[model samples]
Target: MDYRESLSTGPEGSMQAHQVSHFFSAVDVARRGRWDDDALRQLAHLAIPEGLLGPRGNLVRADVTLAQARWYLEGLVDYAAFEQDESLRFGRLALQLWQALVAQNPQIPRDELHEVALKLATVAWSEVRARRIRHRARMTLDTRRTLWFRELDPRCYLCGYKFTAGARDRFLRRSRSPLTPPPLVDFTRPRTKERHLLIEIDHMQAVAEGGTNELDNLSLACGWCNIVKGRRGSIFDVDSRPIGMLDHPTLGWLSVPQPMWVLRIVSMRGRCEHPSGCSANLANSELLVAPYSSRGALNPANTLVFCGEHDPWKDERLISRTLVV
Candidate 1:
């Protein structure tokens, strides 16, 4: 039967069965000592398109692609030693092709690709987690301390209480002073069971969940919040309401009672300010001042909103001249 006809006539479950059957048959051939350049090339022809292409010759649905990738990788996880390596080779090739498909198709949402990558990374979950921890540890003590204080303001991002100086000093000494001898403790004070400020660098998306170790993925959270948010992803429980006001430099605190969601969509889709307002849509624009940073911290101080065409960050002079004034 033609591939297209097979796809249409067979139920979805049956189509998936055919795909898996073809995949494992290819894998089994590789298991037998037939795994070679020509063998792999032929298998690639069968597997890559079967995994990626839909009945209409376009990429498969994101959900279908994700499911197939997960199924194949799970199979790799169970393989015996020699077979495991060959299966891994096949899995990596499949992933590379999927990535290429994502790149070629503008309609494909990148988030779906990221989700797939995250799933594949789970095959070596412990290694990825360890690597991420090591990567974070490799940051200079000074850099880490600076980022902690600057980004977190000596306070927990989740809870607003300021970290005590003693707590801060102890944290710095323990975390940064790797070479120095441990500081002597003063046992005299009646140590009440107060919550000492213990800060942790958290991955907002989590390393195990395919979050990168990039600075953009890192954020400050107290030990309490970090522990609570462990591996389940960020807990955005904090209120995001716009406090019914905006602090304009010239206008002072104007009572702008619009909800943040309304403002964000309005900024993206709203008309320009020119007398004969340009018809160009700013639907894809970011807020001049993001309500939240990419790392997920709220930024109420980000008062200036802008469309894609009029980015405040790009035009520093415009920000100073117009927004500041």
Candidate 2:
């Protein structure tokens, strides 16, 4: 009536189970290379401290001993091998050992222990694959629980630049070449079906200025122009007025601000020399011709995009809002 005999597998499942358990324990507790009964017996020679030894059969607390640390490291290597080899015989045994380890001490953190169990379970699944054995998780998206969730693919709204979900997914589902940038070529006027110069589309209004992602918002930008425009508002000729901050695709023209002459008069303290009329603000760099306008009213229609030094030459009212000191 011994309870031990009732739980014993007696012969068949016992030897294979013993072989797998020995392998897992040797790696987990011993930190040794692959399990062989002969190798394990040698590892056992590395004595466990008498104080740290427990009676439940020879396991040591990983928290305190070098032996336990070695075992954990070796166990990970062994788990990784089993995972790669797709061998479940060793994995099932490993899982039993993990469960037993958790049950032995309630003080042991369960979440960390569960992480080890998951590694073993996943390793077993891989081993099943290696052995050419059939398994339930092999099929793709078999059910709702099985379906993997991911964010909708990201896209650059302004330039329509696209990126991949991840490195592996990129390989499996390599997407087609993205829509090319609008054509930059300019063919002479009389258009023929086969001979028209193509123009690439760009954001007509700046993307940041309350622009929508719709096609109507896009316009053609030549390679030359796009490079010049860069990310900033377009530049204007030195002679142009600050009020015309518009860029024309038809003529490849852009209007920007020009610096003022009074920039040379920056007082020793960095304040504008002519503080009364200009507010020290420059259209390009100079005081405004008319200082009545506030920065809130500045824009494509009135405000000019001028460098700090060049702003003074512009209509004083047309200077940047950035310099309102």
Model 1: CA > 4 A from native: 1-136, 174-196, 234-325
Output the TM-score of candidate 2: 0.16
**Model 2: residues >4 Å from true position, as ranges?**
1-77, 90-325
lDDT of candidate 2 over 1-325, digit per residue (tens): 3434533635422233344454456556545544557756656664432222222112113223544543554454454444455444655645765676587656889878877767655544443343342222222222211212221432222222222334223222343333232222111111121111122234555443334434455433322233333333322212334434433233233333222211111111132334343333221122222121333222122332222344443333222222211
TM per model? 0.29, 0.16
lDDT of 2 at 142: 23
- Model 2 alpha-carbon miss at residue 166, Å: 20
Highest-scoring model, TM-score: 1
Q: Rate the local accuracy (lDDT) of all candidates.
A: 0.42, 0.34
lDDT against true structure, model 1: 0.42
Judge candidate 1 at residue 15 and give its lDDT.
38
